[model samples]
Target: MERERMVRKTEIVQVLRMKEGTGDTSFAKTAYMARQILLMTKSIREKVMKELYYCMEQPKILCIADLGCSSSVENNLMSVVYGLIDTIDKARRELGHGPQEYQIYLNDLPGNDFNTVFSSVTRFKDNLKEKMGDDFGDCFVNGVPGSFYGRLFPTNSLHFVHSSSSLYWLSQVPEGIEDNKRNIYMAKTSPPKVLKAYYDQFKKDIWMFLHCRSKEVVDGGKMVLTLLGRQNSDPCYSNRTGYMWELLATVLDNMVVEGYIEEEKLNTFNLPIYTSSPSELEFLVHSEGSFALDQVHASEISWDANDHKNRSSCDQYDFAICLRAVVESLIVSHFGEEIIDEIFKRYREIICASMAEEKNSVDYITISLTRKSRG
Candidate 1:
């Protein structure tokens, strides 16, 4: 295995957030990613709720954590929290248990726009009051700022853990193999060393994540995670998972040709992302020893899946905006802010051209894990 290299916490926190604000650049304004997250996690979410019902022998207070929960204005975080609560509440009624209070923790990198997240609480609370009336159990939501690669809570503190579209982000760009020339991610053309570097980083990060969660979750606790992934077992299946990035790379390469970007700069740029296969996830779970893989579900969603408002035509510019909200900060940090607009403009054209020949898509994996009982 390659030795681990850390992307400074300060650096990660600063560049990782969606463009913050309530306008066109803001992630809060984009509903596509949020909608798709809910759609993809629907099944395991219910599974986790069912597991929570049986695990909660004394259902007075339940502690739940949402990791990598970026800020959103649609009150997406609270909706998820409430959804979990509703599921648990329904299960409680069915199991002959009484009402219960909840201690919900919403976690993200320290640089996330938590002010926006906290502001939604008032509306969230108001909605709960209207929905449950006097029967509403107390729900307290707090923001936890840190990475999940290490312990973030007290031992035996969590009952359920949920993450969506987050884990595939490696803690850092793989260190030993930075010479993945002319590519921002592990493409089919990426060298074997590049592939091994990403695999090592992902394996290390997942193992550390499981190790920390094992100590924090009580026996039989459940974790549900939805990650950007591919159905193919090979990490180098470019068409399956790397097409979007590949397209983005094409835009950059074209810019380099036109002398709009420095060729040297393009050579050094690499995206710190890895999409794992289900077999890889299963292997990590079994090797970690503290978690048992209960389910692995894979599905393909359109590249423009989140552009619900423009579903009829599937415009590439709309998809560019969605991608911009999530990745603009990183791109700006690497390539400078001045080129941001031009880059996406060209990227939109590339996407539009490609759509005629190929309908771009990405795969997702939703997995449920049960905490192993300690001997």
Candidate 2:
């Protein structure tokens, strides 16, 4: 049984990834919400630059990593790197410092579409040079493929670390959740034990993540993480956006009833995602004892946040497509690609119906931490 569970985990690691390419269905298009959150958060910018300025006091190549830096043909990875470099360069000029060299590591799971990210590097570099002219610094971008729950970098290697729309994903589905039954996540109907199991899994994964990063990041370095979260302390609270997993569970149940999918398969399936509360996040950071919690901010974004006012006509379809880009890989890993269209079709219908009744918005939590000096 243990070996079987390990194999299942291996399969998940091998299969779980965002839908690739630059098409409408790709994560690149859907990821605008994440980018928007990162750009709009004034505190995030301030914290990043403050720590970067501290790192600039040293006269060496600065190391910056974007954990969970999923790729896209649209070069979303490059866009983020560009923003960071621009900010750092501006700070350097104000301090009367010379141009600095940078080592940018774009990290994601092995299943990520790294080819797309690497292919855009030359163009990205050229554009940077054109914009910065004589002040262009030597920037080298490399892709690191692995899980952040474990070590992915050498000790004291990273100066700044940023992760957006990630970290809510536990290393794997919480074990002993077989009794969770019809729900894919911790719903209001879930048993107390199942909730505890999920929270425990989150605590374990997050502690390991912090431990690994504490070793990789230099003392006094900084990290900012933005992830889907809930404002309420209870994990089982029924927020409208938290209903996304429940809606998927309902669709699977319907398919099971209609003989499109097996009942047992639906019973066994569970999403590895968790929406943590700010209190919960703070507790883990303190308990980990490696980093000092700097700031915690929570905000909400609507399901169709990326849609323009003129594009309201197809908001429902666009919302469904965006969700599909995020979860299609996991669904395909379990249920096969055969029913992908039908499942998302029903998902879209349900979303449209639900949206009419109430606005669906997800809570996002941004946490900034500074690495403490090693004892």
Candidate 3:
């Protein structure tokens, strides 16, 4: 049974990806919230760039990797990469350094829409050349398809790494949580064993991630990661992410009761994501022993991606669409495509009803780390 469960997980990983393309219902349209969060951390990224400029000898080429770089026509991976190049170029000029080439690796799982990402590169380069004129060096964009939990780059190849809204996803679902019952994530009703299992799995995955990056990132290189997190220490606390999952589970439960989905299927499924606390992240980084913690900051944003004072039904619908863009693929893979529209319909209603009573917000944790010299 355990072997069978592992195989199931392998299959899920193989198919896991965000909804593709530039349509209204696609991840590209729904990712404005993620883009905002990335923009919020722009200052920290600038600081990292400045430090990188001062710390290392001016290289002819600067190599950067954006792990889990999902595809989008606008306001997505390419936007962030372009912003980084601008930051780098500005810093070089400020420091009186010569123009340098850039090698940007846009990485995500194999299931990602690489064609869309690749198709945008020519326009991206043309825009850069137009903007920077002779100051713009040869900027190369490449797509890397693989899991970030393992090695993806050559030894000491990357000088900087950035990931946003991605690390919360585990390499696989946590094992030994079949008894989590109706919950798809750690909840107040979850057994203590379930919480431990989730945390342990995160620990294992994060440690392996750090170990792999340690081999690939140059000493003194910097990494900035941002993901959904909780300020509260208890795993079962009713944080916004947990509450959202609870609402999703509630919808699935109703579907099962109405015979729309199999009870056994709902019983065995769990999301391959975990929200970590600041302390938990700090502990893992210290234990990994490769990266020195530079800074960790936690901030909250409204779940509806609007001002709390003036949220409307339209905001609720947009929130539902955003959530669907992220998890619809997983739901379809597990239950079937027939239920996608119905599930999200009920999910949107539930969210609207719930928000009528109280506002919902999620905390985002951003951490910056510098690779320490090998002992």
Candidate with the greatest lDDT versus the true structure: 3
Reference-based TM-score of each model: 0.93, 0.94, 0.95
Off by over 4 Å in 2: 73-75, 306-314
Model 1 per-residue lDDT tens digits across residues 1-375? 332233344466557877677777677766465566675576568767777676669556799898987777345655577788778777777777767798988888887788888888878877876886657578888899888888899999898998887899877777766578888888877899999998998999999999999999988889999888988878876447678888899899889999889988888888878899999999999999999898999887676643444343334456667778878888898889999999999887888787668777778888999898897
Task: Provide backbone clash counts, one per model.
Answer: 1, 0, 0
User: Per-residue lDDT for 245-280 in model 3, tens only?
Assistant: 899999999999999989999988799899999999
Error of 1 at 200 (Å): 0.7
Error (Å) of candidate 2 at residue 198 is: 0.6
Q: lDDT (CA) for every model shown?
A: 0.80, 0.82, 0.85
Lowest summed-lDDT stretch of 10 residues in model 2?
Answer: 306-315
The number of the candidate with the highest TM-score is: 3
lDDT of 3: 0.85
What is the TM-score ranking, best to worst? 3, 2, 1
